[model samples]
Target: MQKRILLSLIVLLGACSTEKPDTVSIESQDDMKHASSVAANSTENREEVSLSLLEKSDSKYSYKLNGMKFSSNDRVLKKGSVVQSLSESGSGLIKGSFVVIASQLPKGVIEHYEVNEIATSTYRLIPLEIGGDLYELYQALRQNDVFSRVEIEIDYSGKQTSDSF
Candidate 1:
């Protein structure tokens, strides 16, 4: 009887220690399904949508600012900065990292700006500086004739996937 009781206690402890966490949240399931379907459609019709705009992530808004919920963990602007929404900008220019492609890489661009070259003429501008707002930076780069196009780099840091799975 003593041995049986000890064995039962050990098994109970082992079971508790090996318990799995609940990974699925029904609240975000619809968002995930919509995103996946959009991805499938994009693959079928390449030109129908811009591939650069599609992003997959599981991050949720923890708080609200100015009555708007920001999904990204990394806030692109300074802590106290007021974010201008699409209505205000009239261009849907939300704050985030952007990929700036230019016809020519201008001189002295690295002095006040830090960028990572992704391809021959493609460069990624990381929005880490206090004054490095995406819209403002794009405008600044656009003043020079060297820049051809500026696009927002989709933030995908919110996607949750397990390495063991």
Candidate 2:
């Protein structure tokens, strides 16, 4: 048993020799900190956004702006920044974000609506329009249903899935 234990110790000592390999070290061991700092600075120019609605429009007011937010308490109000409809801008991945509400309605049309966030500068590129199906939207407005479901894409921090069943 003693001989067996000695043999195992000899094998273990042989495996863990202090000899260093001749492989190349790109930088000295302590230089990794400098490399990480350079990398961090290269991609750290992100802008922080405060969550605030900048604009809102519907059929009622003709592009009036006083920088006011919407409220349910007011029965007769005008020109609030709440972006009631969805606006489309950009191509491909950025297409689903940004929206313009009620900018497409005919002359002198007035309604109520909300606005969404300014997630990207892409919103500026999209032509403003009331977001919905053209035919059904016309029917609903004629039928006197003043409000419609507004669709807007936000930065939903979750796994996205296809709508196909």
Candidate 3:
């Protein structure tokens, strides 16, 4: 009787452990699927916004911005001259970042902006000045009809000029 009771207890414990692992595996798989779906939706939304911007500009050009390339049909705008704008600048400190003043953005297009992540619109400010290469980006954004204003923030407080005695 004692041996039978011990065997039954051991079997029940083993079965419970195995069931827990399967449950965890299923939950993890579901989480991964949900994440993938969200990522796909985000990309689709961005593509839609890009297409609409191109339509609004009525340009015939292809350009790459933020690692994504798209084409437009407006001849007046130069190739690789336009960048999509974001609504809210991202969180964190940004030193010497470019500020893009543009017309009202389309709905469902606003996203967080990261520091030094090239975008037409950003609101964060930092102490460091922007790099020279980004000047071209700034120019492109400024020239685009979508943006009414584009300029880099210059933090003058850090500059120390010495006069010769």
Q: Report model 3's TM-score to 2 decimal places.
A: 0.26
Task: For residue 54, give model 2's deviation from the true position in Å.
Answer: 42
Alpha-carbon TM-score of each model against the true structure: 0.35, 0.20, 0.26
Error of 1 at 85 (Å): 9.3
Query: At residue 62, what lDDT does model 1 achieve?
Result: 29
TM-score of model number 2 = 0.20
The predicted structure with the larger lDDT, 1 or 3, is 1
- Per-residue CA lDDT of candidate 1, range 49-164, in tens? 44333432333212233333334333444322333333333112233455667866676676655678999889876544655545456556656677777655432333232221
Sorting all predicted structures by TM-score, with the top scorer first, yields 1, 3, 2
TM-score of 1: 0.35
Question: For model 1, which pairs clash?
Answer: 58-158
Q: Pick the candidate with the highest lDDT.
A: 1
Model 2 regions lying over 4 Å from their true place: 22-123, 127-165
lDDT of 3 by residue, 1-165 (tens): 999999999998987773434443435877889878999999999999999997776555543333334343432322222333232222111123456555454232233233343455543322232233444544555566765655544332333221210
lDDT of each: 0.53, 0.33, 0.45
lDDT of 1 at 76: 49
